[model samples]
Structures are given as structure tokens and as C-alpha cells.
Target: LEAYQKFVFEEDRLRSVQIAHHICSLMQRGNVVVRWKLYHSVFNPVLQRGVKLAHHCQHSSVTSAQMHSCPHHDQCLPQEVLQVYLKTLPALLKS
Candidate 1:
């Protein structure tokens, strides 16, 4: 039973990590609205799953570390992506 539970937990963690990476890749392209949509559609659900799994495991630190280290955690902020988006918008809007 313990081993089965461990396998399930690891599988959930792996899925969460994969989702985070997918979010990062999507964010690297597209406009602000597109990125925000991807966040809502993709990132938030996975994040909720991770939270639930962490809560169930009663080891918040285990998931927290993985969440923090996700590339999106560092790069998901508006200030980071928006600056680049804004700079390119002028050219895009002109075309």
C-alpha cells in the first residue's frame, strides 16, 4: 500500500512538472492575451492539482520547492514578459 501511494505521488509530481514546462514554452511565444489565456487554461489547473497533491501528502515543502523552481515561476510575471511584448507591439501594430 505504501509503495503504491508513493508511486501515485511521484506520478502526480511528474505531471505537475511537465505542465509547468508546457506553460513556460507557451509563454515564450504569443501576445499578452494569448499568454494569459494559456495560463488560465493550462497553468492554473495544474497548479491546483499540485496544491491538492501537496495537501494530501501533508508535506507542503516537497511541492513548494518544485513549484518555485519551475521556469514559469521566475518568468511568468507581467513585468518580465510584458516589457518585451510592449517593445515588439509597435512593430506588430504598424504592420
Candidate 2:
């Protein structure tokens, strides 16, 4: 979890996505519960940053939406961390 958080919150955009994709690949090799936990740590943060990171991934949203603050969840990094990872979050969260 600490490594995941460090990569997401401390690393640069390029490195973060690189780590995310690598992590995604590795997660597929793990059991269901392990995958779920790791994926949650990875994507839940991005889901919160969807409005911000999605635009980085070429997703659409209003200017105000990106600027909007989500105080309930901890502050997300201002940079894009996981675009591809966002693709996996919902299903894993459901599972």
C-alpha cells in the first residue's frame, strides 16, 4: 500500500502510469482478493481524480469540474496518475 501510494502521490505523471500499467499486469496474476485490494489502492484515488486525470487521458469535463475540491476523500495529486487504472476500478470495486 505504501509503495502504491508513493508511486501515485509522489511520482511524475509518466512514471505513475507506467507503474499503474505494470501493477495492473501483476494484479491479474494474483488471487481475487489480492487483486481487489491492490486495485482499490490504485484506482479509488484516480476515480476521485476522474475529472482531473480523465482530461489528461483526453476525457471531457468542464473547467469547474476539474477544479472542484473533494474534501471527503484525501487530497489527490494535482497531476494525472492513472488513466488506464481508472478503467479497472469500477468492476473491481463491485467485485
Candidate 3:
């Protein structure tokens, strides 16, 4: 938790998706309060951010055993193939 806090607060970084996913992962690890806070405050906003960024992306629908990976989905510059992976991605949060 302290490492996450450092990456967020100390570094003045707002990695909303990572932070939200981490909190969700903690919830999956069985923390009632963290789950409550994530559902109440964090989840939707991160998805919204992904949706906004997806506009600049292609919204891929291709089927392949190994799919495309976009490293810079967090940015807004146009690219040939920008995969906007979000929280709702099939079983992303599954362990």
C-alpha cells in the first residue's frame, strides 16, 4: 500500500486505472472496506477515462491467439493501432 501511495502522492502521478485496479485486486484479496471504497468512488471514473482515450484508438475487434498490445494507451496521440484496454476487458481482473 505504501508503494502505491508513493507512486501516487509522492510522485504526483495520477495513474487512475492502475490505482483503481490495485484497489480492486485488494478487494478480491478480501478487504471489505477497500471493496466498498472502490465500488463507491474509483471504478466508474477509471472506466470513463478509458472510454475517452478509446476515442483516439481503433477499438479493435480482430480475433487472434496473440492480440495487439498498446503500451501508450494512456496518451492521446493518434496511432496506427492503439488498443484501449479497460477494466471491463473479459477477465482482466481475474486471478
Find the candidate with the highest lDDT and give its number.
2
Ranking by TM-score: 2, 1, 3
Compose the digit string of candidate 3's lDDT tens values, residues 5-57.
33322222345334544565665665667655654454444455445555435
Task: Give every collision pair in model 2.
Answer: none
- Relative to the unseen true structure, what is the C-alpha lDDT of residue 94 in candidate 2, on a scale of 0 to 100? 66
Error of 2 at 78 (Å): 7.5
lDDT of 1 by residue, 1-95 (tens): 22322232243545434444444555556678866675566544444544455454354343444654544443222222223333443543453
Q: What is the per-residue lDDT of model 2 for residues 11-63, given as tens digits with 9 covering 90 to 100?
A: 36687777777776667667888786875786566566765444443533324
Off by over 4 Å in 2: 51-80, 89-95
Cα error, candidate 1, residue 86 (Å): 25
Each candidate's TM vs. the true structure? 0.40, 0.55, 0.38
RMSD of 2: 6.5
lDDT of 1: 0.43
